[model samples]
Target: MNGLLRFSRGVDWVNAQVGKYIIWLILASTVVSGVNAVVRKLFNMSSNAFLEVQWYLFAAAFLVAAGYTLLHQEHVKIDVLSSRLSKRGQIWVDIIGFTFFLTPICLAILWYGIPFFLQGWRSGEMSNNAGGLVRWPVYAMIPLGFTLLMLQGWSELIKRIAFLQGRIEDPTAKRAEKSAEEELAESIRRLAEAEADAGKKAD
Candidate 1:
């Protein structure tokens, strides 16, 4: 049990690091989109490569963040139903869902995704669009993302079981930590309030 807990923690750490780094991909994609739009509007010049690269980055960010989403319990849930259930009931629901639903889905994706990626790589697949990027790099994200997701599912399953066994606290408890976007929004709100207060004082 102790060893399983440690393994779960290690999987959590890997997903955490991957999630943190993947945020930069979103930023990069945004920057590329902005630049591409500007160039297209101002110069009336555009390339499929730029457009495709943006899609690739967006896909990479979305796919790679699956495990991170699972780790934070940010994945979609029917809280209206589940919230009405007892803690143990909810844990049981999660255990059943992860075991029966999530695991099989991820495994199926990996089974197909690996071959898809391999075919792209072997064929040196490129986009059909003019001046577009190669396809394998983006294709590879499918398997990689699912692998991470599957690992995190296992980690979550282990934690839920441990909780049920009285070896740990509630596995589904929400952490109070704010995300980066939340913190930034909070700072902006505080600055606005301060400015309003200063204006009132001047009046």
Candidate 2:
């Protein structure tokens, strides 16, 4: 059990690093997109290649970040009722909710997403858009994303079991998961500021 706990922590740590990478991805994608548009307007030139690359980059960032999001418990939860319950009661709710609702959903993603990606890979599928520039494989992200989400689900299950067994307090069950909305809002704010500053310099 201790070994499992350590392993789960290790997963969390890895996911944290992955989360950082996703942030960088968002930053890079945003930069490329802005530059792409500016270059096309100002220079009367643009790379369909660069524009297409931005889409794939954004998609990759989103798919890869799912696990880290889950690890942080940043995914939305209806905790209104649970918040009013006692620690033990909360634990029961978590156990039941996770078991009945979450587990099946996670497993379904793993089951269906695998074959979905496989079909894409087997068919050598490419972007259907004629003007679309990015042609990197789309099939890889599904399996990769689903697998990471599955790992995160397993980690959550482990922690929930610990809570049930009384090895850990329910109140502190998931202290690591950050809110996705909070992070996104911050990112948007930062981007808006950067855009405003750039506009001022141009004037």
Candidate 3:
């Protein structure tokens, strides 16, 4: 149990670090997109490589962030019914979902995704679009991302079980501070409310 807990902590740390660093990928993508647009308009020049790199960066960030999202418990959840359940009951629900659903789904994707990535890498597949980058890097993300996510799932499973065994604090307790997703959702909700108010004033 202690060993498992240590492993879980390691996974959590890795995902947290990954989540922090991947924000740069998004920023880089945005910069590349802005530069591409400006160059297109100003110099009447552009390349598919520039456009494709932006997509690569975005996809890398989105895919690699899966484990990070899970670590923070930021994945979408329909808590309406679960909220009414006992803490242990909620943990069991998660255990069942992680074992029966999340595990199998990730395994299936990895089974297929590994081969997909390998074929692309072996073939040195290039994008059909001229001046575009090779496809293997993006293909690799499918398997790599899911592997990270699966590791996090196992880490979460370990924590939940530890909590049930009285070996650790409740894994499902509300974090002290807001997660990035929660903050983003709140910001979006506030923006929507502000827009609605402006519309009402105009009317």
Could you say which candidate leads in TM-score?
1
lDDT of 2 by residue, 5-111 (tens): 77777777777777765776777888999998899999998766677778777888888888887876667877887799987786677667667876787788768
Instruction: Give the TM-score ranking, best first.
Output: 1, 3, 2
Q: Model 1 Cα displacement at 199 (Å)?
A: 34
Model 2 CA deviation exceeding 4 Å by range: 131-136, 169-203
Worst 10 residues of 3 by lDDT: 179-188
Clashes of each: 0, 1, 0
lDDT of each: 0.93, 0.73, 0.91
Backbone clashes in model 3, listed as residue pairs: none
Q: Give me the candidate number with maximum lDDT.
A: 1
Cα-lDDT of candidate 3: 0.91
Question: What lDDT score is found at residue 46 in candidate 1?
Answer: 97
- Please provide, for model 1 over 1-203, each residue's C-alpha lDDT reduced to its tens digit, 9 standing for 90 to 100: 99999999999999988987787787789899999999999999999999999989999989998999999999999999999999999999999999999999999999999999999999999999989999999999999999999999999999999999999998788889777456546766988999999999999
lDDT tens per residue, model 3, 123-175: 99999999999999999889989999999999999999999899999887768
How big is the positional error of residue 50 in model 1, measured in Å on the Cα after superposition? 0.6
TM-scores, one per candidate: 0.89, 0.73, 0.86
